[model samples]
Target chain A: MAILTGVSMQNRRPLTGWGRTNATVAEVIEVPNHEVAAAVKEAGPRGALVRGLGRSYGDAAQNAGGLVLRLLGSAHQAVLDPSLATVTVPAGVNLDELLRVLVPRGFFVPVTPGTRFVTIGGAIASDIHGKNHHVEGSFGNHVRALTLLLADGSTVVIGPQQQPELFWATIGGMGLTGVILDATVGLLPIETSRMSVDTTRIPDLDALFSAMSDGDDDFRYSVAWIDPQAKGRHLGRSVLGRGDHARLDQLGPKELLSPLAYGPKQLASVPPLVPPMGVINHATVAAFNEVWYRKAPLHREGELKGIAGFFHPLDMVSRWNRVYGSSGMVQYQFVVPFGEEEAMRTVIERLSVSGAASFLAVLKRFGAGNDSPLSFPAPGWTLALDVPGSARGLADLLHGLDRLVLDAGGRHYFAKDGRTTAAAIRQGYPRLEEWKAVRDSVDPEHVWQSDLSRRLGLTD
Target chain B: MDNALGEPQTILLLGGTSDIGLAIVREVLSPGARTVVLACRNVEKGELAAAGLRHGGLAVHVVHFNGSDTASHEQVIADVVAQHGDIDLAILAFAQLGDGAVTSKDVQAASEIAHVNFTGTVSATIAVANRMRGQGHGAIVMLSSVAGERVRAANPVYGGTKAGIDGFAQGLGDALAADGVHMMVVRPGFVHSAMTQGLKAAPFSTTPEQVAAVTAKGLRAGRRTVWAPGILRYVFSALRHVPGPVWRRLPLG
Candidate 1:
């Protein structure tokens, strides 16, 4: 076996999550093939962690002063098993690339996050969920098998049926167990890339919650945009949107010729230069929220919209995060169980009255969580908001929200987290010990480590 | 490589330990700027500053740079480029602010101030401009001052040096506009930094962070010049046109 060390192309660079909040320096090594096992074995005491597209909103992919293997450079083709409705793809392949190939073939990823920019490895590691999560579980549920490079420099094929303990641990393990080289994922068949969307305006928090609880099951996907600045009687007023893949008969004659064609185009791009303190302040966000709410139709149904328009509207603009400016922004996402409606209501009410400025506030109903110990979604309400990190009293506000969530039998999502505490993680995941035990057996030396694992004491 | 937030990946700080320079660096750090080269005459101080930024998870590189050493200015910029590739932004923030006594009576002090603040700035600016011009895209932020708008008799020599650099930076900005290189001249009122620790607070006095905020804002807007605290621009505009007798008697000094 050829040991490829020292002579490889490597540079010490800073790496940050999609949030662009906390950045750390690491030696990034570009792994061009499945022989990444050699690089993993040769990594120094700090060990090595794999990164794909750097889409995680936290330090999950960053390893300070250690080796970071960028697996995207590894060229591996995606093979489609047409009859089985499954596609085997390299871990480096991103969902956008996979979609380009699968969509034309009349299939779509079983699970896709808000943005298709995420790699398959990153999606599985984070166990990402989407709008359809209420109907189709997380990305981990559709994964049939994966080729993970163990800490001992040995490649192992693991699945839900084979080494289920390790498989579950690695699903939401944040790349601690091993590096995923490729995965076989089940795909969903689609008649067209367009979605039949329905939108409605809900007056208040009570109405919004009841509407989702009562009607969300009828649609395959559902989400709501809540106005955090709305107070008093208007508090939690939202524009609820529900969508499902449009059938052949649903399309007009003009769209029928190429119903299955999937092409997501960038309409505009945010300028690279960002002003200090950012452009999204309390006033701007409130104004934007109001305009967005009023502009949405009170009731609209069966509107045929492009896949990008229906899902991931923000993805149409490249570098849109720049709108937050140099201070960056924070995305707080948490899930509270079904019975904790009161707790969830209290949190939302507090945020609304606290004068906190959140640009994107989304509320979704999660159906059920998979077997992954740290999976974020549960059969309840999950609220996500993008608040400027520079906002005054943000830390205290989020800390208080964390306490509320924990008390309500809720936990924060690790993929969208940057500042959660170790004690919080412990209280959140009851099966953390079980996941760690399986991790220890596979990599007793803890060779696969990241800054996130270190911060949360997951390596110990 | 730009992060999702579009912040620069690399920055070069000419005056590594300057309060305003460090402040700007901190602001950009949040937007995912990773590599920083702190070039200063004081290696120990530069290393100390670099260490602080490193603690914040940035990759900091310290280099020996004497602002007054005009001959070595080109080499300093070349070295940084060779080591870190094209610098996304280069900050020219090295200057000497002499007191009243030195400005009026001390020839040696006045000469030293002129050499460091004006001539040195010219040297560094030219070197950075040449490299950025070759790269086809880069931003340079020059820290000018409100005192330069109209030299006050209170500190003639210090104000004179600033006046010289401010004019040069503005002209250079015009020259580089077509080359895809941008130059932003920030004119800030008295800033409460180590440089002006005991000085009386001037009208519209600001902090290094505030000045940094204005500079970042200006860079974003592609403005050729900006005023820290912003109100100072109106103040200076009206003050600049005042008769010499009236301006000298205003007690601004």
Candidate 2:
């Protein structure tokens, strides 16, 4: 596989998601812009899926016993029109790569996840949501139009107004409907690359809930980092950060000189090799959470910070996932309806009592969901956590949580979920049948497939 | 695909009537919806075993398979894969304990044991491994034994065949690793199953359930070899280096 041929097909290469769980092998091929249709035509029985940066936490990007295509798309060639406020970029262009090119041009991606290493194709496939999801909706909302490679080797231009059904289905279809070639995404205009921020460390779940529910509407971007192990009176203790783009007038004389400068620093990178047992176990996570909680400011406002510092702090240390070691990690993200705040509280309390060592647990509110049935976000309270993949009784704990989440009319995020069942997905997504109708209409023979799709019964 | 936690969706058990094989399947599929294909020589017994497993959420398909029939291995595997999409896990537990002392002087008896344990296992495993390799990812659990670690004088025929099969499985595992197929060789000291019903229990003897539990852990951890009762791994490690003359004098018999 290290040696490349003219066709660029690496046979039987093992792949895993960012979580590093459930590794599978596929024949990875670098399908060029023109050959995407050809790859679709020649995709064999197991079919084909387009992988981008391997950012999705689960098997959404992996096609077991099939072809995985990496399209050659670059952000350097992006077409940015400040007038219409849109950028037509290749699907393989990562958010960071695009940000480097676009931020200097006085524009920002409408939505970005915790990590900026995600591809445009992956962002749309997962319908990835961010802190701004409560105000701007998910990534699919800003996509004005997208070019797709269908099952029969035919390409189609789909948009919200044109072929909206197929368009939305492809949005969060987990790459089951078809492969996205490129997208014409609407961008958000910004005055500077710096963020004007506010930070608050709430003492308990009750106070944190009321604070978030009250203050979330005021900021364009808002999120809270909850310490999952904090229990009793201190249950769900968290630090909330809310922010928006810093205005030119907000910057000082020195900062105003190069207010649009976008040089995000990489302070350190985690070494590739780590201990077999991993460094992120219960004791270590508990200690880290305690120190992190004590370190956040009691209350602060309008603190000017770099965009990456505010959004992608974890991205500063590359290969950070290696901390989870060979056993890898399991990420569980589910959103319960607004009224079911009790259920969300119960999930937090249970994890606190169980002492399962969930790291970087965050809680947020999502705005109204779009037409995409498989889309993860909704008008609710969403909680996401990452735990040790090899933790004892972790599955049973998550399975129990699944019942509570589903009972509360909540749904799990496909991009972040690595261990949920199809039954749970069936309960979460009421409009799943409708989405399947559209997907099947396009992929009658079911050419598009993935391990996640099969596990969750989204496709064969 | 094995779920993110490495729980398989479909399982193919070559020895349908094996307690350890069924136990491993039970541990993995407990109360969860999954498919299990039981391929064994005895259809009636396999059905009975399948019935026991059906209490939990499982689709148990009892298929006919003759371990001694080397020529039929390929077709049997193909039939299973054709009926069931692809096997996520395959358990090769079909084995023969030759009657009496075959390694002493009876060449015919020795051949009978080798025919199934060594020869049949090699053919059948190759058939399944090939399919698993094509299927991209799979886990194979071969029920080798502690006796195979060093062929014992008390049960030389059974030990001899296991020794050969164990070596073959290890070699096959290395080749299959590049194809995303994992192989786990289970070496159990003794098991109080129907196969060893009347035998005197050894000090570190284990039940089928114990073996199955270890098998499940090994598969989850992607381990190449697993020892039942856990301590057998360390015990065998030390025993592997023991002087032959001193080892033979220890009252193992």
Candidate 3:
């Protein structure tokens, strides 16, 4: 816990999540770890919530009409213990900064989301998983212990061995349980910064599904880039990429010069000013999907790629969300059980028919989920897509998909959700009640709240 | 707590039974656990308007509101927020369309227009803005008449009222920009609603539904001002520079 400002102050700030929609205002306070307890105690009737890099793609980080605390955590203070294979990190520290320090030391985060801009707090709150979910599990699984500033203005350290119920509840609780101050996270010992990869172009959904199911577990990380526009025989056509951390011997002379060098590059950035209607549409997405698919090798093996190129290509463009236009953007990601292949295929078909125009649609397999009640993944296929908010009949289409997904025992990710009914959430997570009960026992006054909690009736 | 890609969770309609106001709400909202609060001087008319919008799952509440009584404004806004949490969107569609003959001679009509359309809205909207700013996220849509773009001579009193509120809404919108609350002014030209059903159809005359459609689009696009039928934006731009005498004499209808 750390927050030490001379005076207690608050700034009236309006903020929107990564998708840039549903802008909400709050009395934002920059709380040093020491002041976090005082800040939470002073939160008004609507209560308080903490925000990280504002990358949840929804209102998970917002607390309208209440207070929002930003913790003063930086990577400079992260203490890594190589002997114990653990790192004590402030919750506000993002992966980008942490990686800058760890990569040269031959280590990597146990789990990494699509974007490195996300903070350790958000990662646990959302319980984020990455390409290596099948091998490593979610962010919460690696979190050894964490400090939670409860609604009663009390700070407590919870972990798998201590107050396990509260620890699991807070993991994917969307910041409703309390504000996380810091965490002792386990790190993966890595050989080099580059990835030894495999790429294969599958002809259709059947081939893609089989390719992943047959051999994905053999690799440490795997994901597929989908072409939603390809219809009939080529429907769900994809380019599969699977890889493991490259060993020193696998690198060429040029790569050997600096095997552990890690500097994620920014090739270009989308400007702040973009058309209100956005530039992405059916035509643009179709062309992009075509070029992106063609650019990849038909069948490549052991291709050594940099960390940035493999894990976060989109990170190269700053404010890339602005390209979606002022109307805002909608990002939807969902996961169904492994046995529900038919349901997953139908969902993909519906999206294609709707012409979702998602240039970055991706599919990945998730391994067994942890005991966290609200965690999204549960040993299944997960698909993520970013669609323009202006998409025609989007609400109706998504609502329809919600029925289909829920009926097949699937659930939407709370982190990537901005528009889903409470009923849908209720149907998705059966353990929601158990998690809420644990949260209530700790803070019955319900001072910890967020817009997502209220929107989906998680805390209402 | 409202959905960005869908209809708002709650809406406050100032005009209560205003046709344009209800129409806009109808167009923007989809069926769900959504609430619409209607505020007007007459509770009966508000109930009647509420009946039309009472589809399955849509909750409509009628509250007493006197646009002329500026003192009661804050309470109206407070009551709605207290009962509904946060008013995601509000429509300032309540207006007294004074007699077109106010310029010739209609003292009572002029005062009514001034108090209700201009003064009442000024007070009520400011109250709403205050609460919304505290909430940190709300949208206010004021239904301004195209007549206000260049205060028309035919209906000077009504035109003058629209002009005042229109300017207020624009400035307030700019002020609220940093606060995250959005204020949009909708200028519809001669909309054929209950208020203007008997009146002669003017140039570029539209329907409440049409005005509502444009308003909904404006809110989505985050536009500060929107003209119904859209072409009126250019028409008013040219009319603003027209000579006073020549503008009055022109066969605008």
Candidate 4:
């Protein structure tokens, strides 16, 4: 392993992945071949950010002035069991690579979000959910066990049967409790690479809710791509898509040959000039939404679409975020309980009325969240928004939404947040006292901290 | 410099001639401290050093501080605080790293290194520690060494002095914990400065510039002890636990 000193500072210009909040730190440590144990020790007790494919779209993988373990280049030794449909993978393995290797062997990840560029470790840290979360739960649910390196510089294996407290604490711990070295996760059986999808464009918010509540169980994966510009009676209007993996009998011979690979070129894109406009004004957003809803393939059920086109359509565009211009963008995701859907509606309405141009709005049904104290998930309806960087008062606007989140008995996902106040955080995560006690007991010197820790009073 | 609340801080360096001492002062005295008193035995040399520091953009003053004059430590610390409000940092950099073999044969040389290095730092650290505890915020940087890990036959006197300072600084660090006072004990190996001139080059050779950078990082990280050529930190861990029989056979200073 090459030990590059901070004295031999690299002159590379500062580059931010997706989260464009904090200023870049000059003294960056890039341990090319450092062992997991050595890197953990070098972080002292302060902990480190284990960076993978850098697909977080936020600060989940950024650590300023602190060490960032680029685990992407770390060792890769995966063991797959075809019969049991489980795979033990190194934390740094990307989802795209994982599925490519396993899907041919008749298995697939139980749940995956809109992107296949994320690492298995990142998926667990964020506890990401897909269209089928209402039935299969979040990614943490599929995890059988995790090999964790605790804050005390000791290694421990955690699972439901052993070290249950630590296991639950780490399920959605967001890399705070420790660094996940590897995971043994269960995979679901898949018949073919294509999805038997059913697409519907709900005309208004009422029909959208009624359609989902009435027919959600008929499909394995369900998602609603909302148009945030819709206003008045048209508020919450969306193009809802749901699907189940196509069985071998359902697929034609041509689909079977190249099972999972995306079809010819169903391109995903947006106007390049739209991102720089910043505010995503109400007038402009309304026009965009009207066109999108009208463009949805009407009444298209049992449509044969490849896996990538069905589940991860956005993966087609390279550096798709450039559409948001130089300032980048923020992925604002929050959850409200079924009873609090009204509160969720109000927030959506407010965002639209305020001209928060959010082109990509994803709505998912989340089941029970993991027991991790700081984990941000609940049995609720979650709405995620992608707002362009040009929006003014972005921080203030998010703060306003944070209050609504706190009021709706919901907590802001630390992995997605960059500007939440400490006071609001305290209100959002009530079990923080318990986490603090554990953190203090293991680290009496108060050594482990991060940008999020300093911002949200996660540490003393 | 500035305290946590933005108030201007004050500082005094007892052995201003020491390179490591000046490095610590240079690292911690920016943005907050309104005054700095460089206390040395020779006023003329101290004035010259202070003038150079002033020319380089620092508020500095020269004063007399003879480490052998033990009774004067309390008064020196008090005078600096009186002239410049509260003393936020008081550095005990007065020490000598002379040849242990030569000092062993020369009683006068051995006594000077012991009294000036070990005793002076102990007195000054205690004096400033008390004042800072009462006022509720101050940091003390004591210059120790890797030689302090074990007393060696090659440089027994110098090693012993470092050992004593290391022990004192550790205790002071623990004692000042709840009182809002902090202590940073620095240990560097084979530093390339006037202190190590004419001596054979050793492994992990370092410069004052490197020492300054690490010390600044340590202060910001709220570290208690900073080791220059950071690898020595792991080296000392093994040396500190070695038995006397095994230690005596090792040719280490």
| Native-structure RMSD, model 4 | 18.0
Best by lDDT: 2
Per-residue lDDT tens digits for candidate 3, residues A1-460, read 3333422324766778899888887878787787888777777787888999999897888988788888887898999999988999999899999999999998999998888999999999999999999988999999999999887778899999999999999898888888898999999898889999999988889998899999999999999989978888878899999999999999999988988999887888888878778899899999998888888788999999988889988899988999988878889899999989999899889988887677757999999999999999899999999988888888888889888899999999999999887778888999989998998898798888888887777776
For candidate 2, lDDT tens digit of each residue in A124-184? 9999999999899999999999999889878899999989999999898888888898999
CAPRI tier of model 4: incorrect
**Candidate 2: regions farther than 4 A off:** A1-10, B30-33, B55-57, B102-107, B241-249
Model 4 lDDT vs. the true structure? 0.71
Weakest 10 consecutive residues, lDDT, candidate 1 chain A? A1-10
Off by over 4 Å in 4: A1-8, A11-17, A26-34, A44-47, A73-76, A258-287, A441-448, B1-253
Candidate achieving higher TM-score, 1 or 2: 2
Best by DockQ: 2
Q: Which residue pairs come into collision in candidate 3?
A: A2-A32, A2-A33, A2-A34, A3-A32, A3-A33, A3-A34, A3-A35, A25-B136
For candidate 4, give the lDDT of residue B227. 94
lDDT of each: 0.83, 0.88, 0.87, 0.71
Tens digits of per-residue lDDT for model 3, B1-253: 5786846778899988888998998888863347899998899999998888888667899999999999999998898888877788989989978677853377776787788889999999999999987777888999888888887667888888899999999998898877778999999998888898778888899999999999988887778899998999998899889988798898765
Cα lDDT tens digits for candidate 4, A112-196:
8888878888888777778888888888888889888666667778787777776766676666667777889999988777789
Docking class of 3: medium
Superposed by TM-score, candidate 2 places the C-alpha of residue A226 at a distance from the truth, in angstroms, of 0.4
**Model 1, position B38: C-alpha lDDT score:** 93
With a 3 Å backbone cut-off (N, CA, C), the pairs that clash in candidate 2 are none
How many residue pairs clash (N, CA or C atoms closer than 3 angstroms) in each of the candidate models, in the order given?
0, 0, 8, 4
